[model samples]
Target: MNIASRPTAATPPPNALITEAVQLIEEAGPLDDAAAMREAMARRTDLPGRIALRAQLLGQRLGLQHELARARQWAPWIGLGLVLAIVLAGLGLAGSVVGGAERRINIMAALVSLLGLHLLTLLAWLLGLLLPLRAPRLSFGWLWMTLTARVAGGRQGQAPVLMRAATRLLARARLLPWALGLVSHGIWTLSFLVVLAALLFALAFHRYTLNWETTILDPQFFLQAVQWLGRLPAVFGFATPDAGVVLAPGGMADAAGQRSWALWLTGCIVVYGLLPRMLLLLLSVAMWQWRRRGLQPALDAPCHRRLAARFEALAPRAIVDADPGAEHPPAPARPLDTGDALLAVGFELPPDVAWPPAGLPADARALRIDGSAEARRTLLDTAAQLRPRALLLACRAAASPDRGTERLLRELLAHCGDCGLWLLAEDGGAALPETGVQRWRDWLRDCGLERIAVHARLGDALAGG
Candidate 1:
């Protein structure tokens, strides 16, 4: 008889076979390959149910593969868009300068052009620094680039792939506060010089207007000129009555002939010159406030709350509920002896918490390899190195236990013992060893590891000095 036409059982069907397959894998039980298969098949005696289950699993796999491919395609484009934006902004700034100088492109105009160029560069750098998080398009762009790299390897044409990879670097904005601050300080310092130049220009122009008799170089004249200039309207548009420091107007003049020219010049100078400086100072002050308030009890409470929310979304867990505010007992730290080679296993940790302590031993390195096939290969390669005191393993725990994590642990354990391996975990769960801890230890012993240390606390000697 054909399996598809097999008679149904007298008992009513309780659950779909696909659901049963997933449930069987999830519920903890003894490991017997043949028995497990028999149990799974027994859940759905009908051939059609078993066939439907297989089809469902196949479809899920296909969907995941398609997502990976789409992510790959998007990654490089994101990176390119960022880099292009930088180049375009630079060019646009140059265009604005050329466009500003309608006819009499004198020394003063040249200086103004230089100042505009400098501001444009600063703007580009800030945009680049904040790109990762601030630029909405970058995340998918990075995802695509990474996927492309995984598929194409070194064989993928270098330009498009590499460019996207470069753009994706914009997303890591945490480092921006310091790096951008240093650059900003430099830019603002240069800006101070620019403002001083503008002030001096205003003073000289005033001196020339009020007293053509007195020498332009006279210090007394310069002082008086500046004093009068400062008294003028803080807001742009009202021109000095006697001063000949006219900024030529462009476009159709609406407020009569000469009046429109004065207003336009004042508007341009205020916007392009004074406004940028004011904005820079404000941003610098705000950055200072954020850093200062970071330590305050009021600020710390809110920041901690925000941080907890972020952690919950990234890696959901029940165990991550420990008070960030409350001081806990420090974990014991043990330094590893230096060897010829060290294997770093793990993913990069978020910046708020410290890892790798002060100084990791030269012979010992660790990588945060979570649930990834590439991560597994990375672990196995280090094991193959076969040097004494070779392998170091570490994991940042999720806030909660889930099926995906449990599968990762199983895979990690299956290939762990080759050289000395150190497994570190933030908290015990699927990311840590669940079963066969002794078996793994035995394998390590056989591979010449003197001793294997296990600890639950994150702030331990194994992490660093």
Candidate 2:
């Protein structure tokens, strides 16, 4: 993580081993400044005392991805679980019962049955919500807060341990709402499904229950339930009910009497209509939680760690100044501050999904680059106008020149040094043109250019042509 050793005007080395080393450093992830430096360190062969640095860094990334994915996957379930608990609590408090008259389950009994479920759901959601706060390896919030603290606190001294711990706590606290939201959502969905299933089962079982007084049998009880669902919206003023059409549940009657359709209708409407709206409400709340709390702020958001690595590769000397000590008077109070040691990895745009340029280009910049020599010049000129120290060039794999493209390569290589160049071939199929491959290699060697890092769009090859 020594930023002071970077070269000021470095070029990619000709050796494949050296080039691979540099690319690894620049491409390392975790999206932090200090992490970027470690990635950069992976390029240095002469650094002693650390043998497994590369493996350790790679392992860290793999582990983080696993942890993050797991966390994300659990988010929805946690939300749903909380929602279910709330629903159960409501039912218990309301003393809601299931089934028709004469065959109905006791309201108190239903509530008692749901109490165990409520407690378990509560425990599960609370554990999930709090796990991020306690887990050290998954402390993204801590990392971001510390980065912000460093930026705000100045770079003159090392960060205090207390401050670091405090930031971690702050990060954990920040994520609590998101976790709770997810739990709430999970609980609601669970409860809704449970109620819907129970109601369906009850309706099915009760449809043919014989009344001693009634001789008639109804065949469309399930169908009537569906119709009740259609009528539910009208219950809430969605549509006016026709006058004199009020439907009310009637108790069982004597044999040869009309069947009780109202009872069946009530269960169906409540299950299909009311439950769905309640579930939607929970989903909306969860979405709001996601938008407000889970999403990282723009400044505190993660950036590509590779940018710093690429910068270090193109101009290592620019970053590493042997004079960090030389600038200040030697004093007990004064200490060299690395100040977060973050680097902007190369600029990473969202990946381009299209291939063959389709009708328009996949990327406007790419279209301009592969269009003509003048277009390339125009792009370079525009970039120069912006005074950017580096430019990331994305070219189609198929568009990469072959034997016939030697002249293009020579031309591109000749002018690429004006600003640090990052030539990105979007497709893995893009090969060095055959005639120019050896020449390009030699030229790269002569100019000390390192390996060109390849970024393949996974599944892009399989996309519709």
Candidate 3:
């Protein structure tokens, strides 16, 4: 059973991996870019928080929320409609066994009619899970999604992103089978139950005789088929017709024989049809819940990554100061109660770029940033706690600047008394391409950090050169 509709895909990526406890990423509406800039610079949340909120706002601004809400509202109805249709289909199959004018039930024909379609669909569902398969859009679950999409104004704006993100998310978590199977089995379970009810009603209320009919098969074959099909049902306490009833000519059976045949058919439907479908429905529910506990969006998707980068430009401190100051912002004399004399953090750097850049002071604390939410949070927390005298944020010179980087710069700058951007390269790093240096210079200026030194080497940055 669905406890709720789908949760947000852009929840704050976990400190380690995504977990259910993560809060819903807030959806936002249109706002002035300037206002967003001021808000971001003043904001205290981490990178993931900022990105999630910004992406949500951007989506709403583009009118995704209305469409998304409509889709979600219709999701359950589509699912329920499929279930209702299954029940009607099964009832129709059961009714096919009832003779309009004759007073006999063709036992074999009735059995095939009730179970044939169910078995075929069940087999197809199994094959889908066994192979390296994506859940087809035509399947009941996806049909619901598609129909709901149409009801919600079709796949426009961020709607497609949500759809692709959901597939990628569930498929990556290996829950596609469990999810699709849940719906599949639910449909079959209800259908089989309906068929069973109809068969019981006809059996109890009508006086029709029950017997097998075959044009080419031997009497021995009918005897064997009944015995084989009835073994398991008999084990479950169902009455099975004996050879006297099965081998009789013209499919004629006495009252007792007819009774036996009736129970046998009911037992077959219950044991093979209803029981298996219900059990599978339960299993799919359990597996889906188990596999999907901590499910989060796979960030590798270009759409989700793009949403995250949407606010890369409007950092909280991307706000500029009214008056200019000296080129170098002076360092704090020292930490008041406690903190590193110098805190050097390595932002996403290549493996070749040496970590904890050499020549840190005795009281310096060195940390490496691997680009995970946890790593970023740890650095931010440490900086806030230590109140470091100087923060030397070392980034690679070759790395292209993005809004995320600028936001990170602003947040890091806010925590420490003095903060500077250090462009790491081997010797003669500062003398590299003029374009690269100037680009970074522009990036820093845009972050309102122009006065902060952009050092080319460890020594020069430390020495205030």
Best by lDDT: 3
Task: Give the deviation of candidate 3 from the true structure as CA RMSD.
Answer: 10.8
Which ten-residue region of model 2 has the weakest summed lDDT? Answer: 296-305
Per-residue lDDT tens digits of candidate 1, residues 1-465? 111123533221112222223223323442233333343344643333433333234324333324334445654564455445534553443334333434222223433554555556556655655664343222222333444555443344333333232332222223233323433433344444444445344433432111122225554453355335434432444543222323223222233423433333344445555566457656755764554322111112222223222232332122223344543222212224323555545443333334553345655555555445686577656544433243445433322323333333334333333222333333222234333233334333333333334333323324431
Taking every candidate in turn, the Cα RMSD to the unseen true structure, in Å, is: 22.8, 20.3, 10.8
Q: How much is 450 displaced in model 1, in angstroms?
A: 28
Worst 10 residues of 1 by lDDT: 293-302
> Which scores better on TM-score, 1 or 3?
3
Q: Write the per-residue lDDT of candidate 3 for residues 317-404, one digit (tens) a residue.
A: 3322323453434322433544546788888765545666557776678888876778888988988887777888887554556655
How far residue 317's Cα lies from its native spot in candidate 3, in Å, is 9.1
- Candidate 1 regions with alpha-carbon error over 4 angstroms: 1-108, 133-186, 193-270, 291-465
Show where candidate 3 strays beyond 4 Å: 1-44, 155-161, 300-465
TM-score winner, 1 or 2:
2
- For model 3, where is the 10-residue window of minimal lDDT? 15-24
lDDT of 3: 0.65
Model 3: per-residue Cα lDDT at residue 270? 92
Q: What tens digits encode model 2's per-residue C-alpha lDDT throughout 108-171?
A: 2433354444445445544655575442322222233344334433454222222333333324
**Candidate numbers, best TM-score first, in rank order:** 3, 2, 1
